[model samples]
Target chain A: MRAAVYHGPRDVRVEDVPEPELDGPDDAIVRVTHTAVCGSDLWFYRGESDRDPGSTVGHEPMGIVEAVGEDVRSVAPGDRVFAPFKISCGSCEFCRTGLHTSCVESDGWGGDNGGAQGEKVRCPNADGTLVRVPDRYADDEDALRSLLPLTDVMGTGHHAIVSAGVDAGDTCVVVGDGAVGLCAVLAAHRRGASQIVAVGHHEDRLALAEEFGATDVVAERGEAAIDRVRELTGGGASHVAECVGAASSMEAAVEVCRPGGTVGYVGVPHGLDGGLDLFSFFGDNVTLRGGVAPVRAYAEELMADVLQGTLDPAPVFTKTVDLEHIEDGYRAMDEREAIKVLVEV
Target chain B: MRAAVYHGPRDVRVEDVPEPELDGPDDAIVRVTHTAVCGSDLWFYRGESDRDPGSTVGHEPMGIVEAVGEDVRSVAPGDRVFAPFKISCGSCEFCRTGLHTSCVESDGWGGDNGGAQGEKVRCPNADGTLVRVPDRYADDEDALRSLLPLTDVMGTGHHAIVSAGVDAGDTCVVVGDGAVGLCAVLAAHRRGASQIVAVGHHEDRLALAEEFGATDVVAERGEAAIDRVRELTGGGASHVAECVGAASSMEAAVEVCRPGGTVGYVGVPHGLDGGLDLFSFFGDNVTLRGGVAPVRAYAEELMADVLQGTLDPAPVFTKTVDLEHIEDGYRAMDEREAIKVLVEV
Candidate 1:
């Protein structure tokens, strides 16, 4: 089998690798039909994260179940499915509470939970971690693009908006116009946010954000962006979704939120330290919510949305490549040339 | 009229000051019947906060309305009332949403918001800012002490527990043993927390916390305290109320919250900077809520609890002093000699 293997920073190659097989009673072998390059992938491809050499690095993948262990009940061989980035036991206290992203036994593919980037991926705890794709939308390419995000980014974006309690007729400000940020704009729109502000310096991404339902865009960063958001939203945004995990973006999210509003952050933090200003947080009564997305929890809902055409998140995919050119897809994402790159297996 | 005035750090003097008078159409002048020395008052008394010299330093006071402006309707002359430490115009958007502390027209008594605090205090937006004392408990000394915290600490504690979403049978952790922290312990108890852990270093405060329904007390600080809380609560507390505004306390609160649980903070931050960790936050799915307390929103409920004897938070007051001895009271609190000090006018 061939797999996209990480060799070093900005170095990846499609190399012949041993095919994944069902190892545990609950494991399933997925023949990758469609996988996407995520913004998180840039972390390892750019050497920003601790990526082991030769590790397979994809987490967003939807495919047909080529084989399944005896214990797998919900999914069977040849069944189309969407696997969440984090695999969970689904019975842990965290999972029971719908926090599958933080499932006690869940593992992230290629990161801390082991690698998954390959033509055939092995998923453990298949019954709890894999959601079968409905037949009505199996052939819908756009719906498949939407499925890729459900494994991570789109679910994450929805988590950011929902956890922040973004309701109808409310104003929301999204920091960082990356793929997840754009998805958040969509999530906010779907959840009935009356006004959405997408803040970023990337013109193309900002335009995509508008297409995804952003009512306004701020090209500035930090305090200037916050000031503009405040000006545009009358006083300040009722909810702020922080999609970039940097300290500056988090601070700006807090600053742009109206007193007593909330800031939901879903970005992976790098080089950030310390706690929030308790005085300002308390003085303004700001609520901050975020963490690993409960992807599995939202998988069914997001898939239903995709199937029903109520949400069209496929526009976030700016590029697509064959599995053989997965390396180039990673590079394009790392260089910010594509909002999201989908790899066809 | 005699009032407690701050001259400098460690320098408070009871001096003759001009009596307060109605300054706005919605203002009402009140002769303070009782004033409590708050932990925040020490901030100005110790010159920790940027406060001007000669500023009258009391904010938590219950008084009899002496005069009312033409537009004052809810509160009239001779009515006994309690006003939150922060004065707010109820018509603001923030106020309408039950966040009176963040009201656009709200002002703190001494810190930042320039307003008078003396033997006679003027309350603006009287109809919305003042809570009338029930006649049945107005003359009860203990009941009046209960009203003291309603102005700030107790209300703040309630806000913390409420924000943390402490439900019946859930385990809660209260960090800090100050007035607000102890009050949080009581608030969680009132909410039917099955087990409550009060983390603090002081024995007297811990005892008060225990009396107020803290089932366990963790005397250790930092990671050690977190470990104790985790061990005591099986895995970790379902909710944590951080009442100390330090970085270490905030970190501890976040560390002890179970995945999907909440960390509510009410303490005023001293000098903490930086934002929460996004990667860990995103991975854990923790919710952080805190800010200026919605005291006015909860005033009626809390007052009813006090009048009905379902809550007895007045035991937190360890000392009583005449207005002339306010300086000594401040020193007692600064030195940790008193849990809380109440002043009689």
Candidate 2:
């Protein structure tokens, strides 16, 4: 089997790797058809993540099950499926509470050895980890792209919106213009946000955001961006989705939210440090909620939306390349030449 | 009129000040019968707050309505009323949402010039701010003391529990041993918390916490406190009410919470740098909510509880003093000699 392996910072190579086998009765082998490069992937590809060398790089993948173990009840061989980034056992207390990200038995697919970016990947706890793609649109490229994101990004964006309690007719602001942020705009739209503001400095990304249902785009950064959002939404947005894990973005999200509103942050904060103003927070009555995306919970429903054409998340994939060009895909995303790079296996 | 004036840090003087007069159609002159020295008041008295010099200080008061403006329809002259620390117009959007503390027209009763510690207080928006005391319990000192704390501390404690969504039989943890924290323990008990952990180092305060229905008291601080709470609760607390506004206390509250749990913080954050982990926050799926206590909204129900003897939050008051010795009351709280100090006007 061939897989995308991380060697060093900014260095990825397509090399031969041992094929994954069913080690447990609940395991399933999936032949990768399509996989997308994520912003989080850049964290390790650029040597920012603590991930070791030669680790399996991708978590987002959609394909047909090549084989399933005896205990795998729902999914069988030849069934199309999407696997969430964080694999859970589906029976843990945390999983029962819809907190699969913190599931005690969950594992990140690619830790030390390259996992999902390979042609063939093994999924543990198959019953709880895989969502079958609807038969009618299983092979549709756009539908496939949309379904891939549901495994992580789109589901994460929905989590932010839902956790923030965004209601129909509420004004929402999305901080960051990455794939997740763009998805948040769409999520807010689906949840009936009357006005949505996308704050970012990139013209291309902002344009893409506008297409995804951002009512206004502010090119400003930091406090200025907050001011623009406030101006765009009368006083301030009732809910803000902070997609960038940077400190400045978090501050801006909290600052721009209206009193009694909420700030739902999805970005994994990298070296974030700042004291939240309890006085201001108390005075304003703001709520903050964030964490890893609850992708498994939303995988089934999000795939349905993609199949029905009610949502088109594929526009976020700026480029698509062959599996052998996976390194260049990582480079394209790292260099900001593409919003997202899709690899066809 | 005589009022407690903050001349400088640790320098409070009982000085003759002009009696308050009606400034608006909804204004009223209340002869303060009982005024409590709050922990927040000590913030300004100790030069910790950015309060202006010569400012009158005190936000918690239960008094008689000596005079009422033409627009004051809810309470008549001679009516015994307990006014929430924050004065707000009832019709604003924030007030309508039940967040009276964030009301656009809301203002604290004690600050640069607004002082409820004075013999007479000019309560703005009197009709919306004052809650008439039940006549049956008008002379009940225990009930009145409990009602007095409801004007701020008790109400803030209730706000934390409510915001955290504490349900019957849920496990709860109260951080901080201040008046508000102890009150939160009582509030959690009243709300049906099956297991409550009160985390604080002070033995006296901790004992009071146990009296208020805290199932256990963890005298350990920081990470150790979190460990104790987790050990006692079998996992992590389902709900956490942060009554101490310091960064460490807030962190402990977040750390001890279960993945899907909520942390309600009512403590005013003092001087502290960045401490909240936003990245880990998303992964944990913790909800953070707090701010000013919405005392006005809960006054009626809490007062009814006080009158009915179902809840007695007055044991928290460990000291009583005449209005002339009000400075001593602040000193006692500042020195940790008293959990709460009551000043009779």
Candidate 3:
């Protein structure tokens, strides 16, 4: 199997790796058809992540199930499926309550099976962790591109919107113009937010945010961004989705949020040593929620939206490349030449 | 008029101060009939608060409206009223949304009233900030004692419960057995929690917690306390009311919360130089909310419950003293001789 392997800083290579096999009764082997290079993956390519060398990279994938073990009841051979980043047992107390991110019987960060940036991969806890794609769009390339993001980024953006208690007619702000931020703008739009403000500096990404349903865009940073959001919303946004996990992004999320509003953040915290300012956080009465999203919980419904053609999140993928040229996808994203890169396996 | 004046740490003197006078058409003068020494007030008494010298020091009070300026429509002279610690103009964007603590047109800390421990307070934004006590409880000493806490402590406790999204039948844990923590126990009880665990070391305060409706008490600190709470509730509590503002207290609140549970905290953050740990906080998926509560927003409803005799919060006042012995009231609370001290004028 050919997979993308991490070597050192700015180095990801496409090389032959050992194929994954079913080790448990609940396991299934998925033939990867579509996957993407995430913003977080850049952290590792740039030597920022502590991930070891020679490890398979990538956490987002959607494909057809080529094989299933005896105990896998929910999904079977020949079925199209989407696997979330985290695998859960589905029966744990946390998993039962829709908090699958904290499931007790699951391995986070693609344990044992490695990652999805490969031709084929093994999936554990198959029944509880995988969602079957509808038959109608199973062969549709455009629909596949739209549905692939539901495994991670789009689901994460949806989690932020829901965690912030964003209701219809709300004024929501999306901080950071990454792929996840663009997805959040779409999520807020579909969730009935009357006004969506996109705050980011990149003109190309912000332009895509507008196409994804952003009602306003503020190309500013830090306090200036907050001021622009406040101006757009008249006072401040009722809900803010902080997609950049930096400390400054968290501070700006708090600053531009209305007094009783909430800020849902899903960006993986990278270099934030000091925590958020509790004094100001307290005074404003802003609610904070959103960690690793419970992607499996929302995958079925969101994928349905894609299949039904109600949501088209494919515009986020500005470039697509062959699996053999996977390093180009990484370089394109790292150099800010692309908003997101789709890798066709 | 005589009021409590702060000269330095542990030095509170009841001396003659100039009578309060209304300076705005929206102002009203409140002749304080009852005031209390708060847990936060101890910060100033212990030289921990940066309050300037000679400032009047107190924040919880309920009294009769002695005079009202021309534009004070919601309250009038001779009307009994309760003033939340922070005064807010009800017309502001935050106020209209029930977040009066962040009102745009008012000072947050007592405004021009100086402090509630004084004989009379000149309340700015009186109509928006003051809640009229019902005529039935006008001269009821017991009701006055119960209602006075609604201005701060009880209201803060309620904020924690509401912020944590405590629903009926939730297993709740109150971290900190102080007045606010005990009040949180009561709030959780009133909000229909099926199981309530109070975490603290003080036997007297723990006993009071049971009286206020805590189903169990864990006389432990740090890890042991979290263990006890998990044991008491079968796993972990669905809602956590963190009434202690210390960093360790915040850590404990996060440590024991069920995945997807929330921690509502209202303690005036004092010794926490470092903020909360976002890494663990994000992983746990625990929502954090509650700052300076919009006590004025919850005051009217909570006071109604007190006046109707559905709640009896007066037992929290373990001691009472006249205005002339106000210093003794502060001393009793400072030394932990009383759970709360009421000062009658």
DockQ of each: 0.62, 0.67, 0.73
lDDT of each: 0.83, 0.84, 0.86
TM-score-superior candidate, 1 or 2? 2
| Candidate 1 local lDDT, residue A195 | 93
Residue range with the least summed lDDT across 10 consecutive positions in model 1 chain A = A108-117
Name the candidate, 2 or 3, with the larger DockQ value: 3
lDDT of 2 by residue, B6-84 (tens): 8898999899887778887898888898988989887887788777778888888788888888988998888888888
The C-alpha TM-scores of every prediction are 0.93, 0.94, 0.96
Higher-scoring candidate on DockQ, 1 or 3: 3
TM-score pick, better of 2 and 3: 3
Alpha-carbon deviation at B78 in model 3, angstroms: 2.9
> DockQ: which is higher, 1 or 2?
2
Model 3, B56-155: lDDT tens digits are: 8787878899888898898878999888888889998789888988889856434357578889888889889888887877888777888888888889
In terms of DockQ, the best-performing candidate is: 3
Error of 3 at B240 (Å): 1.2
